[model samples]
Target: MKDHVMRLAVGSSARGWRVAIACPRDVYPQDSDSSRYLLEAGVKLIPLSLPGRISPHGDLMAWAGLIRILGRLRPRLVHTHGFKASMVGRMAAATFGVSSGYRPVTICTVHNSIAGQFGSGSRAWNLAKLVEKVLARSTDGVIAVSRALEREYLELSHPSAMLVTCIPNGIALERFISVPPGGGGGVRLPSDVEPPGDAGPPGDVEPPGNAKPPGDLGSPGVLKPGRGPVVGTVARLIPQKGVDVLLRAFPLVREAFPGAELVVAGDGPMRSQLQALAGHLGIGARVAFTGHRNDIPALLRTFDVFVLASLSEGMPVSVIEAMASRVPVVATCTGGIPEVVEDGVSGLLVAPSDPGQLARALIWILSHRDEASRLAQNAFEKVTSRFSIDRMVEDTCLFYQEVFRRKAKQAACES
Candidate 1:
């Protein structure tokens, strides 16, 4: 939610823009990029890990905790993200307004529709939507990640467009920028690997950026932890992400390229089903599930090809991270993917829910080594030139500045 928006805006701002994020403790545990960026930027983080996701842990004392917290953290601006956090956080901000912190502006980001719950006809789905309708009216503003999502959110009542802005998520460049080509490091960059350090310093290049420092250089990056043409996919193993579709396609990929291995990261309810599908396809032995990793850059370094076979998305940061790492991506052409990858230029795209086409694209990239390498190099260059973290931060920073400036001017005119 807002964390995704803030992540894109982190370096965009001058680094001092204070934020009190309301997330579950698990959402930003030590290794996630969200945690890394928050730590790097030195922003004050407020995690809401009440016992039941965002619900209270004991004695139904959530109300007391909210009052105590909002009173203490009188932040300049409070932004609510996701389901639990947004619900609790919005109410907290409203309470602060009536009793204290009237100066703080409260905003919420609707990453998904409250109506879009996990299952059909589920009571939680209806409850979540009801809660969201209340929050939208109370929050100062709303940030929507995609037009598709915006329409869903506005189906009910919300403030005017002036109060709700469409701000898509962006990948942070610093988190993905390659190291220059070597000011003096001796480790050689991997032939197919791209990471934050692989690009090397722009000057006298003695080593590759992806190469570990002198001490760590003895170990290779690309071939590390295992061998074979490694494929990395970062998405929750759920229906929407199309991991099942990827599993069905993997058998065909193995038929074409027997030396390949797959690394599936992240977890969800459908994970077991997808894993079973792998066994049914007879490729289960070749697949490894890392279960929600924080070492994505290192994982990217090991992968030769990156794939995002999702049924839908709104500009995924993981795909951008793959591009930044100079990995050739084979993502499905759906939702906001076309907005990210240019076919035959940055990476290849295929239709969603189509296993054969997805397999064909993967096989094509795997067989044409030279073509894959060229595309990977071009993708890296594109990230460095256009999608750099610095640029995202700059763009997002300008967006926030403009919004806040307009906010101030409107207040003045009204007064």
Candidate 2:
């Protein structure tokens, strides 16, 4: 998407900046708009693919690759994503020593602190905590999408106390508003003479072999030949995400709206457990677990009402995408959700981990179509106005500038 944005949009051109994106693997193990963005913007992409993703084995592999990259590209700044990347990336910059006078500022955005957030009072969780404590000191910048997460990082004693900025993830505003719910996204004649190539996108991936096919997946909200209102949640099926809470709540929603179906997107360690839980809950027949796919937009379109029941989060990308798809959302108030949803206005906000409350909200959205539409419209307006990719990129770029300025000042004092 980054490539497409730069090639087609203003201010994102290759001439505007010299940039580089470093990831363990090529940013696109499979081609994506992100890879395209790097190519078109002419940013040098240095893939630092590591060997294992397991434990010490993965750790050593990642560290070696990252150090090698630092020795080569050695850009003025580095922004790392995910815990593994940040640890290795930040350590490499720090190894260069303070004598460099901050020539290369390191930044990390915590996508999901799974090991920290998950695991119930266990030694494994504690080790993750310890790792975070050590890694926090090496990086120059730490960005958290939620105030909750920023607080978590601060409590962990991150070195840059004041550098912790809360920047929520954003969606492309015009895209959300223009693409109506369920692809009722009214057909507007594009200037293109031929239909956009299929190789292009809206297609990111195919479902894993173990998963069901798209149309066959029996999503209730999908307006297909045989479909009903499917209250869906797209997220990792981890304990912290509270997928179980949603599962428990489904029985109630099903009782109220018997025809209602439940669709779950994304896959994780808890996939089998969730399927088993659905069976246990007696709504197994109504449940569809379409593992992760690039066709999020289509899935979002299928949701007559969307639900996010995470116990903790950082303003999820799913909610924003749903609002863009014009699907009314019923989410729990945990992370940065309150920032996006305006209670009874934009969407309904219920307490986290309460299945009853979540079920009630879902039922309300279903029973009242007019209200849902109005709420969807409100959500659409809110997301389009406040949460946008342009805003996100601009804020991020400004941070880079600040880091650059700080580097220059530190250099002059040293000289």
Candidate 3:
């Protein structure tokens, strides 16, 4: 979510829009990398405490804070991201209008499916749907990051009156596409934010002692000469990401290629549990659990095949990054993944939570170098043509204009 915001905010700012972001100050501390980056990019930071979960007190406080901020800023548009922010932001926009006769063009971006995250028919899902239906009446427009999410919004009872569009998430292609096959110079981070040493947490396993450091790899997917095939993924260690499913499938990958290695990058609450699961599967020594990495471009160069075992996703930027890096992909056919990866063309797809199917896909990619390269190249071309950051930003700004024009016409008709 932070990445999506950073890309959009920076891109929008570059186009000469005076943009400001209202975010939870506690979550992104004053000294955090994101705060520094946004400030450096000339984007204003409005510290608003929006709770992640339901809290009557917190929600009330957030709504009040938004009202105060919106009243002061008096911006022409109030664009919010995710469920919680949308609920509070739209209500504030509506309430602020009643109090001050000023209403901003309110827009919300749905990055993931609420029902998909909290299973359909569940209490949380039902409440979320109800909230979205109510909020749809006030929202001027909505942007779904994938077609799947667009369909979900259209099904809402009140969205018929709202402008809902699918705008796939995009990345800065230049960051990933410029790298050489083996990995050109890694993406540089702010000096204060760069990870120390090899960029893994303490006690994290390093590559084989004889291998070259990650910075000096000779070929894509091979850390050093004589090392085994490397299968890697970058996902938060959470249930929704299905990292456990990847752990179960790794043993099968080792069966076909004994020297195969698995590297799970990124951190979350389930990190310890996943590391233990790898130990239980007896592939502990072969797996590297690097907790939270900022150096994705460099890390991706060490992967023979990139896999996403997510139970759900909304056009995952990680997969696009891998494709942009020219790495072959194997991802689950769930949510917006199928839309991103054409089966057997750009990359292979497997049913979610199916270790056997996932293992087969990984083995096939590793065994068939020619086919994998073709798929990787196809993916690279597709992403370059459709999902560039410039394209997304331009499309978004156009939508903003269309919404404003429609609102103006409606107001004039009433008068």
Per candidate, the number of residue pairs that clash is 15, 9, 0
lDDT of each residue in 1-415, candidate 2, tens digit only: 2222232233333237666666545445447676665576576666766543545677676666766666666666777766666667677677654534443677787766444365546886676677777866666677776677777777666565336687677765555455544663221111112232111112122321121222432222212333346687888777777999999999877776556678888789999999999998887777878776666776677677889998877668788889888898988887677788878778888888899888877766666566577778888888877778777667777777776677668669999
- Model 2: residues with Cα > 4 Å off, grouped in runs: 1-15, 30-34, 51-54, 98-103, 113-130, 158-162, 184-227, 411-415
What TM-score would each prediction reach against the true structure? 0.73, 0.80, 0.88
Residue 139 in candidate 2, Cα distance off native in Å:
2.5
Q: Give the poorly placed runs of model 1, Cα more than 4 Å off.
A: 1-14, 22-42, 51-64, 99-103, 112-130, 147-158, 172-228, 268-270, 395-397, 406-415
Candidate 3: where is the Cα deviation over 4 Å?
Answer: 26-33, 184-224
lDDT of 3 by residue, 51-102 (tens): 8887999999999999999988999999999888888889899999889998
Pairs with steric clashes in candidate 2: 1-33, 1-34, 2-37, 3-36, 3-37, 24-49, 220-228, 220-230, 221-230
Alpha carbon lDDT of residue 382, candidate 2?
Answer: 82
Q: All candidates' lDDT scores? A: 0.64, 0.67, 0.81
Residue 411 C-alpha lDDT in model 2: 65
TM-score of 1: 0.73
**Can you write out model 1's per-residue Cα lDDT over 1-415, one digit (the tens) per residue?**
3446556435533555655555457767767677777777765555554554544443135545665777887666666566565677677777767786364666666665444444435787666667777766666677666666666667655556346666655565565555332112221222225322121111222221111112222222232222346677988777778888888888777665565677898888888888888888888777887677655766676666789988777656688788887777889876566667778777888888888888777766655555666777877776667655555456545556665776788789999
Candidate 1 vs candidate 3: which has greater TM-score? Answer: 3
